[model samples]
Target chain A: MANTMLHINHIAKTFNPGTITEKKALLDVELTLNEGDFVTVIGGNGAGKSTMLNAVAGVFPVDSGKIEIGGVDVTHLPEYKRAKYLGRVFQDPMTGTAATMNIEENMALAMRRGQPRGLKWGIRPMEREMYREQLRTLGLGLEDRMQSKVGLLSGGQRQALTLLMATLKTPKLLLLDEHTAALDPKTAAKVLELTEKIVAEQKLTAMMVTHNMKDAIAIGNRLIMMNAGRIVVDVSGERKKNLTRAEVMGLFEKAAGEELDGDRLLLS
Target chain B: MEIIKLINALPGCVSQGVIWGIMAIGVYITYRILDVADLTVDGSIATGGAVATVLLMAGVNPWIALIVAFVVGMLTGLATGIFHTFMGIPAILAGILTQLSLYSVNLAILGKANLPLNATKLELLISQRNVRALSLDNPLIVLAIVTAGVIALLYLFFGTELGCSLRATGANNAMARAQGINTNTNKVLGLMLSNGLVALSGALLCQYQGFTDVGMGRGAIVIGLAAVIIGEVLFSKIFNNFALKLLAVSIGAVIYFVVIQVVLWLGLDTDFLKMLQALVVAVFLAIPYWKGKYFNKKTGKGA
Candidate 1:
């Protein structure tokens, strides 16, 4: 009886079709997330994991199928239009925030997402205190440097800021595409912890793509594995809660009919 | 080189620089804020002059003529924007295409290579004859007031939410789109605003010189860029405020003209002035790139 936050039905995508370097990135991929469900996605290289997330985010049009967020058909909506219903964090730290703008300006832009931007002042004086409060919660001491340009921030700090910006409006679905992959180990762990806390605090429906098998099994309430442009394994509830890395690998091997070949995935 | 002659010319040079400084502010919007090197200024400036001249000759009010020129100039930007965004042309090429097409548009508007406004018969806002005047009729005084007005208006506009979106669109396109900004529309809006200001400068320049020549704006983009680079090189560190930065660009234009005047007085041939201007701009533009490439030590590992 739960509301469905996202419904991606039979989507397929082909990059550079009919060319010498054609790539079938996604094929007949179907996914649905109930309200408050957190799903973690895992796959080897060339699997449709990130593609699925991008598909849902409307980065590109699907070759086939319909996408709906909050029961609104969004199949033909452009990425910016679809952004009204989704919060997304990219793997690259530079992809989420405007580097030249100050910290408060970036947050101000995010806070007005999906709303009509007019000739009124971009950042009101009252909003500065709110931004300071939010930055304080990050515990990175960014609260004291609200006027500092984002380009001066380290990669981890930018990613953390991007995470904060993404969740500021409590989006119906949060898409994290290897958002912590580029950070150092300690920072990655810290960001991951923050991600879990924010998602729980907001009780947001979310999908996360990760290469680390441990994180894939450990974080979310549901797990979906993709390979060869299709979902190869899906486990949830009690089964996913008790799932181990070895057991997930066994399941991937059984479904894929081959050994997991991503060394980075296995090593991580 | 008579010192008295040079002193007499200095005021005129300053007046000319301030007039062109308005055009350079237009250039700053595209080149600095929107991060586009729009070549459409060359054609659009001339278009403004031609439109204003033709309108003035028809006995229309000069102020109304300037406004009409500004609106027409915005149309030129619209053409380039459509070419770049809707038609999928690259930004630089789109500007070039618009510039080329505007050559014919300018000719059609003027009906000749030159159009003159008789300042004696017409009540013009500014003129070169009053360049040395110390009274209210002095072109320098009027131009300074106009330039200050332009900077104040732009400062206010850029602080608005819509303006912030435009700035974000230029700073990081991907991030802007992800934040629900329609970047294409913002880009078009930026282009229109820039070319409108450029055209307004053109109208003022035509009224000041009392004539509009088809070739008056030939190297306009270069001059605008020279002013922008000179301004940033000289004042970027101290002029952190938005209005002050615009003032810097205007002052930069004045410096450019004063330097040219000095070079002219130092026995430089008038025939070689264009080449000298080009060289000055090239060197100024290269300084930052060279500093980044040759002076700075590599600090971080390559990704």
Candidate 2:
């Protein structure tokens, strides 16, 4: 039995509808993922990749269509209401974790995501020990500095901590919106490696949006290409594993009937 | 002789400081923890004083009257919270709207400009008459206990799940929502808790002065901000603990009042007090911004 983990059906979203600045961000976008599937999404600027992720996250109500998570209809759910089933890491490290709070506190928050938060102690002694072990896995020496505020950390450290926070509760679907785009190349590679480790260990269903073409091909079991607010190409299984950067560009051009602009989809 | 006069005024300044210090703690919740400069306290404090005085005059228990005052104050916060969250108004404007409407509501509660809680007829929790008294009835002793109790309760509350959520909401709305925390409800809850303390402080202030005046809280927000800034400047390096931060706020209020006493004893005109207070707060508030813009710029990172 192949259970569907995420179902985004014929969804459409238009920003500032009926205005001068109107943008059809997503038009008839349909996507579905099975349990434990890791899909990589690649697109140009304004290609609607992030918008689709936001739609699934329920950042705003879609103009049309329905979405389901774990076979449960969530089209009308608000962002926070839908948060129980999803873990999200944003492109900007600042958007994923609370800076003023300490590392242990941030993890404690993620550990209880979707759970009823009440008058109980926010972090228990046992939970602290567990968090210490989890932080050690990052190999970033954060375990010893659990009490340090998240604001004091470098961008790479924050991104790693956010990745750990997102998967702490084992979300039904993990959305990574270019989670390492803001970091230096060295740090970016390190965080990417960590992301792979976490997803594999948890057997998590995931969607990763990236600008680097090599990353889209080299990682994830499936690859999706988007252009002009719709998916232009999708490949999975063994085909996705053997794909090269040049092949993806050729596929994009053939499917969209337009040259894949070098600036938008970098081969290198 | 002048030194003796200043020394004689010390006890009164300390007691009044403690009363306003509690109000400052309430301000600390919105200003420091929630990142909101809530002006609702100005009117809500008057509302608390009005409710307490009216109830005390009608033969209610002092403690019970204070509780009622606290509840009413929380209602004012709810109104502002709804305006800001549900109605999509800016936080500052929401607070201002509630503060404006509360003036009429408070007048209706009292039905006059002022109401007296005479010590001769009514048993008070704390009173100005006991400033020189050595008994437990001394306003200083009673207020200190209340301040300590309030700080302890707040410290515990902030360590709880719901409390951390509220803190997270203040720290970052986007992250809080991403974590499945409802930022709207948390903001409203924070507002309610803050105003409840503000009202409680107002109730104590009413009892201490033996009267509740509708205009008593006119500049209350300034006093609260003054206390918060003073506390931050004096104890930010030393008091990293939550409870100590609150205690710093209370002590800050005491220092504020003592300074005022010294200025008065030095023959400054009484009419210039409000302007003086506003000036002091403005300068202190600008210091951080100026430091970041001018002094810290050379450090090579803005963070």
Using all chains and alpha carbons, the TM-scores for the candidates as numbered come to 0.97, 0.98
Please report the TM-score between candidate 2 and the true structure: 0.98
Q: Can you write out model 2's per-residue Cα lDDT over A25-97, one digit (the tens) per residue?
A: 9988889999999999998999999999999998899999999999999999889989999999999999989
Candidate maximizing lDDT: 2
Off by over 4 Å in 2: B300-303
Global lDDT for candidate 2?
0.93
Worst window of 10 by summed lDDT in candidate 1 chain A: A259-268
Instruction: Name the lDDT of candidate 1.
Output: 0.91
**Predicted candidate 1 versus true structure: per-residue lDDT over B82-179, tens digit per residue:** 99999999989999999999989999999988888899998788999998887999987778787888889899898999989998999898889888
What is the clash count of model 1? Answer: 0
lDDT of 2 at A76: 93
What is chain B's TM-score across the candidates, in the order shown? 0.96, 0.97
In the range B1-303, model 2's lDDT, one tens digit per residue, is: 389999999999999999999999999999999999999999999999999998988989998998899899899999999999999999999999999999899899999988888988997888898898988778887787889999999999999999999999999888898899999999999999999999999999999999998888888999999999999999999999999999999999999999999999999899999999999999999999998888667776655
